[model samples]
Target: MGVGEFSYRISISTLIVVFPLLFVFRLAQGQLHVVGSLQPVVAGPGDDVILPCQVEPAFNVAGLTVEWSKPDLRPDPNDRLSRVDYVHLYRDAHEVPDMKLPSYIGRTALFTDSLREGNISLRITNVTQEDEGRYRCFIPKLKSQTRFSIVRLIVDPSLTETVTTKAQLDPENFHVPDLNEEIDNKGGSSERCRLIPVVVLCVFILLCFAVGGCLITESQKAELKKRPI
Candidate 1:
């Protein structure tokens, strides 16, 4: 073969062998992603809030280690793995106690029921003003750090309080008399008023009877005293 022809044959062989291997290699490394919402999750202080996160392609993640952390917390500089006190961590289908931060131990929980559906959402109960910040939902086994997403949390105290206040102050919650009921109550009052005079008349009649009996008894006693003494 000529020089150009020989070079062309070698290039074709290399392409045939290299392309299939590259395709297989990429296929073996399946895509693992942690997807989250772009919008800030608004919550009130002392309210339960859900930080939504899901694994893309809907793979069962019951065995995988999932971590939810506040990015603002100071990370340990000496740790090469970049592991810090995580807000919540799930491993081997259960929550790991030692891996969780003290503040987040009782407050955070994962939805284990949705793990089969690739949902790794974190629920934070009794959220405080300090809980407002960026949260990262990550899986350490997923080699690429870019797969994890950040969720911004916002705590609106006034908005929640206003809603609670409005609920408490609702007209439906107060005792408002109906028109028919008010009329019935008025009738009842008039009936009670009418009964008062009747009761007074009966009492006066009883008093008159008692006085008459006393007078008769006294007159008899006076006659008896005059006769017997």
Candidate 2:
């Protein structure tokens, strides 16, 4: 074969082999896409809210790092140790508390049990009005076209008040007597009152029998004396 022709054939072979390998490599790298709720997650004060975020096609992200943060938050000028403080961080199959902001400490958590299912949703406890804002869910190690998602949170005070009102008005919170229990108590008292009369009549009958027996015994004794036996 001619040198040029051989070279051309080798080039074509290389491309054919390389292209499929590249495709497979890309697949292995995972086309993992982070997804979040499009609508804002509304929550009340003192309520716990979950910011929904997950990977499309379901990936086991148990070993991967997940970062939850506020995109609009600026770095703390006072603390030079951290470039940026995160809302919640999970790494090496555990949460990294040192990387979290003070406001989010002990209040934010990732669903660790669901991490294998690619659920990186964050739960915020005791939500406050200041917590309302857009949140970002990011996976820096994910080699995908989209490695992050944005979700908005809204804390509604009026809604919280309404919920509080309803809770206060709940009948279970009050010490109201149960209708069935009240009826039973009334029935029991009346039954005891009725039993008292029956008990007294029985005692009276026994006493009369005892008195009559005593009188008969006395009469028998007197008859014996009169016989002089």
The TM-score between candidate 1 and the true structure equals 0.55
lDDT per residue for candidate 1 within 1-40, as digits (tens), equals 3446545655665565556555644543554455676566
Query: Lowest-scoring 10 consecutive residues by lDDT in candidate 1?
Result: 182-191
Cα lDDT tens digits, model 2, 1-229, are: 4446545755665565556555655564554566777666787788888787887668988998898888777757787874667899999889999978899999988879998888888888888999998777878877554567667788888774323211121222222122222211211112233244355555555655665565556656766777854
Cα TM-score per model = 0.55, 0.57
In angstroms, how far off is 79's CA in candidate 2?
A: 7.5
Range of the 10 consecutive residues with the lowest summed lDDT in candidate 2: 182-191
Q: What are the C-alpha RMSDs, in order, of all predicted structures?
A: 42.0, 38.0
The number of the candidate with the highest TM-score is: 2
> Which stretches in model 1 have alpha-carbon errors above 4 Å?
1-30, 76-83, 143-145, 161-229
Q: What is the lDDT of residue 24 in candidate 2?
A: 52
